[model samples]
Target: MSERVTPSAEAARALRDIERRRGQARAADQESRWVGVVFGVAIFAELAAPDFFGDGVRSWIGLAVAVLGCVYVVMLRTPRGGALLGRPTRLRKDELSPRFVWLARLAILAVMLIGPFGLRFLPQAPFPYTRTVVGAVLGATLIIFGRTLQRALTSLALRRDDKDGLGGATYGSR
Candidate 1:
């Protein structure tokens, strides 16, 4: 009798693949905000529009952010994304701080959803109907996140350098 590969293993493999994709997606997500900034700027010159149109833009941004957030969380939870983001070869174990990462991502996800809605209806904030708030929030988050990710990656490189005694290790003391 031959032992076949179990369905769970296949599922696990699939999840791993998804996780890898999510990491790529996260890096890409940083880009998404930049794109949104450009788009927002392009539309900023507009002096007039229907109120309902603003609502549509908010809804769209919220949905997009939620979708991306869902993807990110799914991958992070999976073995593959975790492996890539936390792999010793890619990032130092200390640098991948699950606590900070989860908090930052959750903040992004919340902002992505809430910010857009605020743009639509938050009366106290300027540009409440401009739909630019989402882009601004996203861009700011990306700026911070990009740095954090880079630092995380650097921590790993630093560890490798330390191991090699390269006399050039300068990270991961924070």
Candidate 2:
């Protein structure tokens, strides 16, 4: 005779595993969103300095913002123990491709570095006008990344739910 397994016991084990995975995915998603927002804000603030601060003050302010952004990025690059940001638990490898991550990082850095000189494209462009435009672009980029992260997390959550036989109710859905 084959050994018998209790249905309740099996269900409980599955439920527990599912909960554990869900928590990991949620934490990963939160970290991704926070990183994107912080970087975006830093870029915007750095570029906006010219609008509010005089040349001498704006230079220092922009340098401060850039340094902070660099520090945050460095923290993310460090190992789990050294990370200033919390590590993700259950995020799938393919959910965030390394190539894409690098590309996004490079793009953000380029924007931050080049944004201050955006006014030069239009000779004699007003400081306020250039700052406003650059700030808007940086803000939009952040929003785009935020949406991308949300979608990635949603898809990951959906995949996990399906794998766990949790049916069609997605984690973010009602």
Candidate 3:
């Protein structure tokens, strides 16, 4: 029989397939990051309530948009690890918390609880107080988010640690 060029002989075709898969994975990762960023921006936007268009409700509109954006993005990216029965992606618990993150977060929150009161008596009047309150709320929100993620990541990291004895240490990989 005459020698024929099988699919394996086509480097371009193989490369195309690999590229397509890579693109898909990248898209999924991007979707996940977008969900996080959009949600964060939404919370802050709603809280800030900027005077855009002089309409007090525009910030709420931005918040609504952010919610929709997050929902759409989440629909696109399948979760990496969960109770689902599939060809095992990331293990259910393969994450860890950074050093002193929890403590620093707590300290920020403690100061915030005390800062608003301190700001009111400042020589500059309500300006510093207003900014301090807003900053504190935003910082508190961020800390809460970080803690929740840390718990999830820690569970995953512990699982990996116990499985492979990998020493279970990571720094802000999330």
Candidate 4:
């Protein structure tokens, strides 16, 4: 004879599964903190290259950074790459609010534009360290803000899942 499961038991099982999946997702998000650090260091290296390297070497460094960036982007599109990077290969529209997305983009753009331009107007320091200073600041900002933004996005995604009655179990299923 086979045992029959009650509806309540099935629902309880689903809830537990959903919670487990959410926990996993959160862990992955935390693990992705390294992504920001890596990117920040790359930015710092790219900008500070001129300070420490000759023209020929700086160009090679720039090329290397560009190639690595391209590789990272291409990898982001693949399942294995996404898993390796601790990021989702695809994000559902409901997981991110368009307004917030736009705001974030605009803020980043403003910072990018303002930083160098603002630095240009400042009196020359004893050493020609403008690029180095800018690079360090921008790199640090990226590392700090990237983690905060990721957390906020994760929270938004989780809230959306709860609101949609999915409980995060259906995340990335589509």
Candidate 5:
């Protein structure tokens, strides 16, 4: 025999579950700040290698760095890696605006395609260390802005949750 659950009780339970999951996602986001630093350093090394090493050595270094990055990524998918590195979680569709999400994706894609080539074409005199400069700027951006961006996205999701009738919850309060 099972007890009946009222609609209000079920709704409350569902809201509680949503809050729990959102809390976990926020924790995971905080834990992933270090990941940005790791990839930032890797990107800087890959780009800066050519300035300090010969073509052959640069290729080898780049290969090694790429392999390491790939391995780290693969490891992050494992249980132990998730414990160590924090597994990333996706926001529910209702928690994000599709238009904003698509715009962000497109912007990232454009930067990925144009950034390196665009840097190469800059005047040599003003930007002698073009690759290094770009790498450092990108690396620094990742390391420094990663947490900030995460907070912004988290806030956006929370706002959506509030709009959906869940009371607004602050990251600190969670």
Candidate 6:
């Protein structure tokens, strides 16, 4: 006779809870990723628009788009949400530490505070080149931060999956 093992009721309940939490975490991760993309787009728009965040029509449009993105980001918050301006998810043990969350917020705040001043101080280069320069800087920053956000989410999800004895590796987790 072959021996078989079945989960206890308590174990089954815990597994269900883990599955629910994982699903929520996955949703939160996706939402967080979208927020990062929107943030990047907003930064790019603010920097790459014709007059560099002025009162012109293009600037107004850019601001409107950014504001809408911000609204969407805020709407993503769940009952377990954490780090309003940064992580955009519940706390995780292996990833998104509180210190890291604060650091991410500070870094973003620094960019927000310093970017415009840095641009103003820069020597006014030729038009096309100036646009290219701003685009490159902001675009690069966006890509970097987007990747970082994605990695954090992926790490958190993978760690949770591991803790819960979830069978599959997700998002190329090692």
Candidates' lDDT values, in order? Answer: 0.47, 0.60, 0.47, 0.72, 0.69, 0.58
Instruction: Tell me the TM-score of each prediction against the true structure.
Output: 0.32, 0.48, 0.30, 0.64, 0.61, 0.49
Model 1: how far residue 115 lies from native, Å: 7.9
lDDT per residue for candidate 2 within 1-174, as digits (tens), equals 998789999989988987776555554544545666777777777766676665666778767877886786676556552234554333444444455667768989999889667746867756546875878697768856775766564553343325424332323311
- The digit string of per-residue lDDT tens for model 5 on 1-174 reads 999999999999998897886666666645466788987898888777777674566778778887987878776556566556655443445556666777779989999989778868975636556678888998899899977877776665443426744332322221
lDDT of 1 by residue, 30-149 (tens): 223343344343333221222435544655655655676576566555556644434212233443446666776898999899966866885554555443555455455545465565
Best by TM-score: 4
Q: Kindly report which residue pairs in candidate 5 clash with one another.
A: none
The weakest ten consecutive residues by lDDT in model 3 span 82-91
Expressed as tens digits, the lDDT of each residue in 1-174 for candidate 3 is 998778777867766765575334322222233344555555555544543334577666666867776755454334432112111223222333333456657889999888878767777635534533574477556545744574444443332223333322222112
Candidate 4 C-alpha error for residue 28, in Å: 3.0
Candidate 6, residues 1-174, lDDT tens digits: the string is 996656687788888986886665555444345455666666666556765554375758666876876666555453333344334454333443456566768989999999888879978766654664776677667666766766565664353325435432222211
| Model 5 ranges with Cα > 4 A deviation | 1-24, 88-94, 116-120, 123-125, 157-174
Candidate 2, residue 78: how far the Cα is off, in Å: 4.7
Task: Please give the lDDT score at residue 28 for candidate 4.
Answer: 56
For the record, the alpha-carbon RMSD of candidate 2 to the native fold, in angstroms, is 7.9
Ranking by TM-score: 4, 5, 6, 2, 1, 3
> How accurate locally is residue 114 in candidate 2, as Cα lDDT from 0 to 100?
91
| lDDT (Cα, 0-100) at 88 in candidate 2 | 32
- C-alpha-based local distance difference test score of model 4: 0.72
Question: Which candidate number has the best lDDT?
Answer: 4
Span of 10 residues, lowest total lDDT, candidate 1: 165-174
Model 1 misplaced stretches (Cα beyond 4 Å): 1-53, 83-134, 137-141, 149-174
